[model samples]
Target chain A: MKHPPLLQAKNLKYSFNETGTSTHVLNDVSIELFPGEITSIVGPSGCGKSTLLYLLGLLDRPDSGEISLNEKDVLKCDDKKRTILRNHKLGFVFQFHFLIKELSVLDNVALPMRKAGKSKTASYEKARDVLGKLGLLDKSNRFPHKLSGGEQQRVAIARAIINSPSLILADEPTGNLDTENSKKVHSVLSKLAIEENISVLIVTHNLELAQSCDRVIKMRDGRIIE
Target chain B: MAMSLIGIVLGIAFFVITQAQTSGFEAFFIRTILGTNGAIKISDRFQDMDGTVSKVSKDGNFQFFFRSREEAQYTEGIRFPDEIRNALASYQDITGISEVLEGTAELAGSSRSFPVIFQGIRYHDHSQVSELNNQLIAGAIVDFAKDPMSILVGNRIAERLMLKIGDRIVMKGGTGTLQLRIAGVFETGVSQIDKKRIYIHLSTARQFKGERFAGSFFQLALDNPDKAPELAAQIQYHLGHRSVSWQEREKVWLDVFKALRISSAITVSSILLLSGLGIFNVFAIMVIEKTRDIAILRSMGFSRFDASAVFLWQGLIILFLGVLLGSFFGFLSTYFISEIPLRIRGIFSTDSFVVNWDVFHYLWAISLASVFVVIATWVPARRAGKIQPAKIIRETL
Candidate 1:
């Protein structure tokens, strides 16, 4: 039996205009992320790697594109419908580990679950189990600011996966970490794709991190080269 | 947040203090006047007489008195005093009725002559309606009622003339002059009453005015003073005399008090409004500082409404806390301020500042705070909600 990729984007295009000067950011970019595969997008700065990920994660709109999650077209969804799809099907990890300073680590992780209409107990128990898997259960009560950069990034990963989404989209998730912390975050994302059969797509400048992934999409200017 | 909360607290405290002081002044004045005037009075421009008392040319106080009989005589004021009194006597709402003979007279002391208002009454009937008897500081209350020539003098009047009880003074009125002895001196705390008013027997006042069966007005005290206006109207319709409620007689003072009320309300509301502006600034800065956090939450599936709600809750929580603390401080300030002794003398007298500790003032303070905060919070919350996660997320990338 043959099956389609878990997430796919075809001929995605986006542009930004500055005072009547048009700059094309993404051009005819097509890519597929399969289940149980850790895929990485490698590019230089301003290479549209993050833009393509944003379009795939439904965080942004493309000038023209065909995007599908489990064979359902996502490009046609409205802001509200796109948000629901993002909540239920797509998880995101930004570079900064943008955990809310006002909330404790456990609350930050459980926020997505709570937003998904899960019970408080169910969300907290799930969040606690995930934090324990990351060896961070004991530190769940601490605020994000008190934690080191690597721990905060791991907490961000826990938050991303708490909704149990099929696809995890991480944009340079460990770009700010030292080698040790970067290895830690890379191992967590690889484990999420392999152990949980989740489709992981990462955009990063780390060549080793990209090469260790199941697939790597290289890009220049606006179009994917491989 | 602290600054805004402090603003609210100070505003409410000032409001509480001002409201209490204004109300205290008004109450003190009204109470002092009511002690002398009763709750309602029925007065007629024309004197009660035989035949007809006609308006000669109707200006201010111009009137023509005509007697039909060859041997002419003048009767009392108020066309049907007996009928009016008899009609009002049985009403359950009416507590007491005193026939009043009020006119200005000259008191010629041996050394000084002072102009005074002579208020004549049947002592027992007047005592039931007023606090005059209780205000008698010296001499006997009986002398003013029992002896035709005996009068109750105000303390200020007696002091000005250097006259004491049993001192004979000549009272000159429109009719004639007569020798009257001061029997009592009263102090009402209010300077106007103590300086310009004197009480005498109704018969003596009539004799001094050279009119028998004459009454200037009837002072009626009701069991419920709040019903004065309605009762006054009813009594006026029945007796065909002009009636005035206690509130009506003090309309000028009430107008001035209303202005004070408006000014106080403006003061409180403006302070609350400024507090709200402070809250708005605080929340706006928080939203801007946490722009990336808001973006991350939205990326984590928090909808715009949810993002907005976070700030809304923050604002509401601050408002609730501020109002709670403000109310406590406001009440405490009122208590402390009311404890201060203030002896104020004007149209009325007060030994201390009067304050109304009505719970409604607290409720009003809270409501005002809520209104301002909600308005203050909405703008920042809406701005926070409108922030596109993609814009911030892309910037961070």
Candidate 2:
């Protein structure tokens, strides 16, 4: 029994316009991620790895493309529907933790569930459970500012996975961390993909981390070479 | 947030205070006018007249002629006052009626003399129809009634002639002069009336004028002064006499007061609008400062409407707190103003500032301030919603 690809992007093209100059970022790129697989997209600087990640995350519109998430074509969806899809079917982790400083670890994790129309009690309950699994339940009541860099990134991961999303998109997830913290984050991502059967796609410049993934794709000048 | 809250508070406070001040002035003016003259007055003056004449010939051939004729003959004063009084007495709204003879005379005191408009009234009936008894600042109406030759001089008249209670004065009318003693001094707070008016017994006016002298008009008091216009019209139609409501008689002054109210409203509205602009500035700065946070929320699947609603809720919270604190401060301000004693003596006189505490003023302040707040917050909130997550994320990267 084989699993279907959780996310598929075909012939995606995107460009950036700056001061009347257009720079083509993603040029006719295509990719697919299978469920329960951790895939790494490794590239040099200015190679548009982050651009492709953002397009797959539904955070930006491509100049032209087809994106089918969970077997549903999503490019034709309006902004509101796209936002709903992002909330229900996808999760995101960025280089920076991006935790709201004012919110506690519990609240930061609970936000997605709350946005998904879950009741406050249910959201907090699930947040605590996720934080427990991430080994940060004791610090759930503490604000993000008080957390270590690795701890904050783990909290961001908890927040992303709180809604049981089918896919997770990570851009430079461990770029800002040290060796030990990066390994810890990498182990957490691999475990989430294997144990929870979630499709995890990471865009990073760390070839070591890419080599550790179940599948690795190399990109140069916006085109995947391997 | 503090700056925005302050703007809303100040705007709402100023609005409530302005409303209270205007209401106070308007109430004072209406009180003075209604007290000086009852709610309605019936006289023989011709208010509405139709002089048009129509003629029709059998064959539709007729010569039309137009001519100006002498004024139609009418009685000097309200005709059959007793009959009209009896007819109006059955009305539930008409509280009291008094016959008064108004005449002009020169009143001489020991030091000086001044021309005066004197109202000769039956003291008992007049007390029911007017606030004359309550207007007395010195002596008593009882004393004036006890002495047949006694007169009640207005405060301004007393001040001008240097007369006090029990002082000897002589009133010289068109026909004769009568020596009288001042029994009381009253102030109606109307400069014109207080400066030139006096009150005496109706019998004294009849004796001075002639045996055929009748009351000049019938003053009627009503249960509700606001209903004067409607009742006045009805009375005029029923009795065929000119009936003037207090509002109609003081039309010019009322119009002036109305204009003052409108101007004050505009002034306060402008102040609130400026305060709203302050709110706009603060929120705009907040949106800029929180750009990263907005981007984070947008990336977390918060809809554009949710982004906009975040700021709108901030505005609403500010509005709620502002109205609460502003109303409290507004009440305190009006209370303090009313307690400050300062004599104002021009067209209207008061020993202290008048402040009218009306719930409507607070409601109006809240309503007007909310409008301004909505307008103020909407711009920044919309900007917050329109923020592109990709752009912000890319910039941060």
Candidate 3:
């Protein structure tokens, strides 16, 4: 049986204008994100993996490309609508958790729902369910700073999936973690993708992490090489 | 939110109390003056007019008899109720309401004699209307109702004559030279009134002026001192003529107080404005420092509005504290300065205490200043919102 990708990036291009020069960061980048699969985009340090993640999360506008989320072009939506779509349909995990230190762990998990204007009770219940799934129910009220590296990454993962998004894009989510913590994060991500039928595209430098993904796509200047 | 609310209430308490005290004191002064004196007054050009504007005005002192028919008619003119009758019968406020008298007096020392115009006031009524309680320094007020012949001298009069209380002074009036004893002396702080005041009983004053029913001015003590202006208004209405108020009678002093009020306003505004600017600077620095926190909030699904709100909250908190602390310091400042003797090297002195504790002026000053602070905070808070979350996250990380 054949199925369409949950997200399709076709002819994705980006550039930064630097004093009358077009600094091309990405060119003709294309990939497929399918449900229950982990795709790793591996490259050198400044090869625009994070830029690609920013584009995928709709945090930045591409110079030219098509980002189809669930078969609809994301670039066509208004800012407010785009934000709503981002909160509802796409999950993002950054290198740093970027977790609001002031908010509780449960509140961090419930953030997307709160952004989506859900009631407090519904957001809290949804937050608890996701936290419990991540085996963090006991620590829901604790703040992110109170948690360790691997546990915080898991909490970040819980936060990412709290709104039941179709695709999760992690920009080196475990980049700061040690080998042991990174493996622990990888297992949890793999379990989440398989059991929840969610797709994940991770940008990582570690060849071992890439090898463990369902499919590994290598990039040098921006073009994907499978 | 609850904790934040507690902070706000505490801040408002510090705000409102200082505001009220300043306001209450201003009210007290304005009340004190307006109580003893009326708010407004109308007087004739020539202050010594009897009922009509007669060109040949009798001097402030004279003497004589009135026609019996005129006296009988004059006595029949006035009527009163029991409450009013009882107060007037006892002559509590009025030592005596009498007549204006003119005299030439000799200075006891320096032997310089000059013609002086004097009015024999019911001395008790003089104190009731004069606000002598606020007198800077005083000897004794005269007992005119008890001793019809005794007299009180005005501050300027006493100064010029070089006389104090318990001085026997001889004055040549229209009929003869009458010897009167000086009972007490008072200063009204107004130049004109303090220059030429002389008091005796209402009957003696009429006797000195020489007309029983003829008087230079109407001198009646109010039934109640607090209700003087109201009663004055009623009497003026009954008389259906242009009448004079004591405030108009003492315009120079009123003008002085008015000037005092204006200067106080200017001083308070300058101080509050400077304090507000200092607070605004504090808030500006605070927002700049919290830029990263605001960016994190924006990234955490908070809209630009929420981020701005967070900054605004920080501003409001700081301003609330500043207003409180500033007012607290302002009070302690005023009191501390007051505590140190006001007449420091004779350079500074005040009516009562620091700018006479004006409430409305200070509150208006503070509110105007704080509004500027609030507006000033907006620039920084909006700048905070403009900070990009990803850029901040990248930069901070």
Candidate 4:
């Protein structure tokens, strides 16, 4: 049975204006994300894959496009609502493992929950359990710099899911990881997407990683190569 | 490198000096006013108003005016001259005692109008007359005498009136009028006192008032200048017998200190605002420099508010370090300038710029300087909130 799409984008267009000359970044790109599945977005360099992801994540708006989370038309949602959706419904992982180094691992993981108004003890306990599941329970109190590259990426994974987001959007998360770390991360992502029935989108040029996903969407010159 | 060090050094020094200036005045006011007057005053402040006061015994001989004789003994570390001497040896903190004396027109020369402070003084021990002289801009101090009419004129008044010693100046008091001769002209460093205040003999003060009266309510010097309220309390306890420390009895020196403080506060705040703004600019730039870090936090589920809080916290941490260090050196600078290794008085009694550990003062200066830190911290905190995590992440990736 094909249920409603968990993440939807329609006819998104974006351009960057430099000194009055328009550089068309994303032209008529559209994609849909569904629950209980992984969609790997494979694109050539500068193909606007990250740009589309940003728009879908409500991190930026396009020249003309509509995005919806579940059945809610999120393009019409106010800024506060967008922030709420981003904070609760959407979890993001970057290639750089952009964990705030100043914060302890548990704090970085618990951050979204804290923003969602979770009580301190509950947020801490939830983050701790997630860290434990990610095998970072012993490293919870350690700062990000102290963790190995693999452990740090794992911490980032625990952080994204700690808020129990319905959609996880990772932009080349394993791009900076070695093969072993990348495989370890893929296992974490695939297992969480399947077990929690959460929608997952990974943007990458790594063919092996892309080929392993349930479906691969290839892009060239900012349009889907259907 | 020199400019940076100068900025930091001068910034710290200016902050400390200006802060010390304001702090000193505030400290002095509390000491002089709070000590001289009670911690809080309950007085018929308005001239014709029945304000909150005078619940004491209403014996016709008992007025609201009184002083604590115990202060003198407690401070002298000696028993007051005898209880008889104590009874006669009063402690006075009078503003000015004016009397009208109707005397013979026996002066054969000049009859000039002179402003005189006819302090109804009985002895030197009680009337801290030297304090009046401490305010002298010029001229010598006169000894208190038993005779009537002989007095001292401030230098400015003497110069303005063009009259020296041996010239006669007449004054009218609240009671009878008095005629006094300028046996000597004394200048208290205070130009106001040098030009205006006149010291008249106590006998003449009584002669003008039509009775033989001793001023138990004259200007007094406290044992502990810092604990004036304690002195006032002891006065009420011991001398419920004599006088009151109302607004009327404060000396010119106290007012001078107050005016100095108000002006210093305004001046220091302006200077601090500029320096603080510089500090703020630096810190804001620091936040901007750490733009990537801030964006990473925001992108990692931290809201704009959380990012701002982190910056503000960092700025506060910087302020804590700078201010704590500045205060230590500010204090050290004050002490160093005071000792000057050469006994030199820099601009504005630079002596006060350096001081021993004064809690009331150090705390005030440090806190005032911290307000700038808050403003400095606030700018950067706000800048942190304006950061776009999405934009930053896109740029980095």
My TM-score estimates for the predictions, one after another, are 0.82, 0.84, 0.64, 0.60
User: For candidate 1, what is the DockQ-based docking class?
Assistant: medium
Give model 3's share of reference contacts: 0.15
Candidate 4's DockQ: 0.29
Clashes of 1: 3
- Scoring each candidate complex against the real one, what DockQ results? 0.63, 0.62, 0.24, 0.29
- Please report the TM-score between candidate 3 and the true structure: 0.64
Candidate 4 local lDDT, A9-72, one digit each (tens): 8888898878999988788888888998999999889888898888888877888977888978
Rank the candidate models, highest TM-score first: 2, 1, 3, 4
Better of 1 and 3 by TM-score: 1
Return the lDDT, model 3, position B344. 16
- Residue range A145-175, candidate 1, lDDT tens digits: 9999999999999999988889999999889
Candidate 4 structure quality by residue, lDDT tens digits, B251-319: 465566567666765665565566677767776787778888777655545667777787677656656
**DockQ, cand. 1:** 0.63
lDDT for each of the candidates? Answer: 0.84, 0.86, 0.63, 0.65
Model 1, residue B254: C-alpha shift (Å): 2.2
Candidate 1, position A201, lDDT? 95
* C-alpha positional error of residue A108 in candidate 3 after TM-score superposition, expressed in Å: 3.9
Off by over 4 Å in 3: A1-12, A19-21, A28-32, A64-68, A71-78, A101-107, A110-129, A136-147, A215-226, B1-152, B155-168, B172-196, B199-293, B320-362, B394-397
Model 2 score (lDDT): 0.86
Q: Pairing residues by index, what is the TM-score of model 1?
A: 0.82
